[model samples]
Target: MNFDSYASDVMAATVEAVNQLTPGHARGRDYPAARPDLGDLVGEAAVSSEDVDELRAYAFKIREIFVAVDDNRIDDACEATNTLLAETQAAPTLSRHGGEPWHLHFHTPSERWARGWAAPMATALAIVLGNPMHDRLGVCTATVCDRVFVDVSRNGTKRYCSTACQNRVKAAAFRARKQV
Candidate 1:
């Protein structure tokens, strides 16, 4: 099966959800506006404000996984992910929907909004951490940003979460050089 697509897509959505749903530099942003993209992770699932709040709590847990990885605490990351996997009761299943071809999915018995999304996300993350490419997951290195990302670049050298953050750092360095 296409594990790469699963890992990349879920991880990207995880990043978006965490950045938009949780507080930090991206706090003041609108989660509702970002729902379209986030919806890819949970198709057609109904979510309410209380559901969003639960998701916001899940966001914090996901962020901890990224922080552990970024901090070079691989064991901690794995343990945290394992805890989430157990909590969410994530299990693999074959699902075909919307006339799409049959493919793999991680499912949880709980119909709760947070666990619904958390199961697949945690499953994708477990797949990565179980492999050598676990380092591909990371929290943005920008001091001003706590965003998380999956480094899918060919060289796997990504540090910043986005080009905007990369450019901001570059511009700051240029200004510093001029002053020096």
Candidate 2:
């Protein structure tokens, strides 16, 4: 359970998935057709429409963690994460399967995609929150996007979800200056 790598990878992907897959106003991706990362996170399980529905709801819950972190409410984020962990029954188990090296997994081997994901997402977030890296989780500052991101930079100054969003904000500022 390396919190840095685990949170940067798994939790990052899950947060991005929530931004993409969650129902909302015109996010820029064709979520179902474009999300191969979701498949990777769920391992061999297929994602169904029902799973998407579940994830859409779950996205709101996950957002609470990010929002709490963003608002400097670490305890609120922890409480929310604790509830999710309890609900998901997260357990850390290590095993080597499919010829891969032994690594940690949070859900039972047979858990459904949504439930399975809930456990690890919560666990990864918990790892981050418990450590000094709790501030690593953030919501994008871009006006058009509410995507979450993990700040993995050396200086930890990251503020947007992606370079595109960063550029968008910069360009918007430039346009505003030009208009003025």
Candidate 3:
């Protein structure tokens, strides 16, 4: 099964986590990021208050990977992703969950933290990066936003993390041109 989309969701979520946890960049108007909400992303995994810091750190690393990609530092991104993938030790298998069709599973029941929360995304990236679709990993192109996204479009040309960000950027540009 194609894990690209699943991996992209993880990347986007991790980027959001990073932007939330490490604030104070002082870019522009205040748009409060959603608090490090790993619960929605973890999907049935038990997350504790004590797990926040570790998850945050893990997210930072994921952010670094996307930042490297956005900065056109492919080598750095590869290195960072590889390091994370190695640490995760993902093992691929086929399984069904939540009444969904059978799909490839990257983490085991015993895996937690890195494997449980992070490995699937890491393995997804590994799967894509091994192919020509490596460039799909990217950061949001919206101003005052440092989120990440994966381009699964047919032409692979995705910019903003979401439609909202796209509209914001376009509106900002329109206002700028009007003022000029």
- Give the runs in model 3 whose Cα sits over 4 Å from its true position: 1-34, 93-103
Supply the global lDDT for candidate 3: 0.68
| Residues 1-180 of candidate 2: C-alpha lDDT, one tens digit per residue | 246676667776677667766544223333342342465655666778788667666677888898899999999999999998998899988867788998888988787778777788888888899998789888888775677778878788899888988888898899999998
Please give the TM-score that candidate 1 achieves against the real structure. Answer: 0.85
- Write candidate 3's Cα lDDT for 95-170 as tens digits: 7777999887677766665447677767666666666677777777777766666776788889877788888888
Q: Worst ten-residue run, lDDT, model 3?
A: 23-32
Which residues of candidate 2, in runs, are more than 4 Å off? 25-39, 42-44
Worst 10 residues of 1 by lDDT: 27-36
**Candidate 3: Cα lDDT at 15:** 52
* Number of the top-ranking candidate, with TM-score as the measure: 1
lDDT of 2: 0.77
Q: In order, what lDDT does every prediction score?
A: 0.77, 0.77, 0.68
Ranking by lDDT: 1, 2, 3
Cα TM-score of candidate 2: 0.84
Q: Which should have the higher TM-score, number 1 or number 3? A: 1
Error of 1 at 94 (Å): 1.7
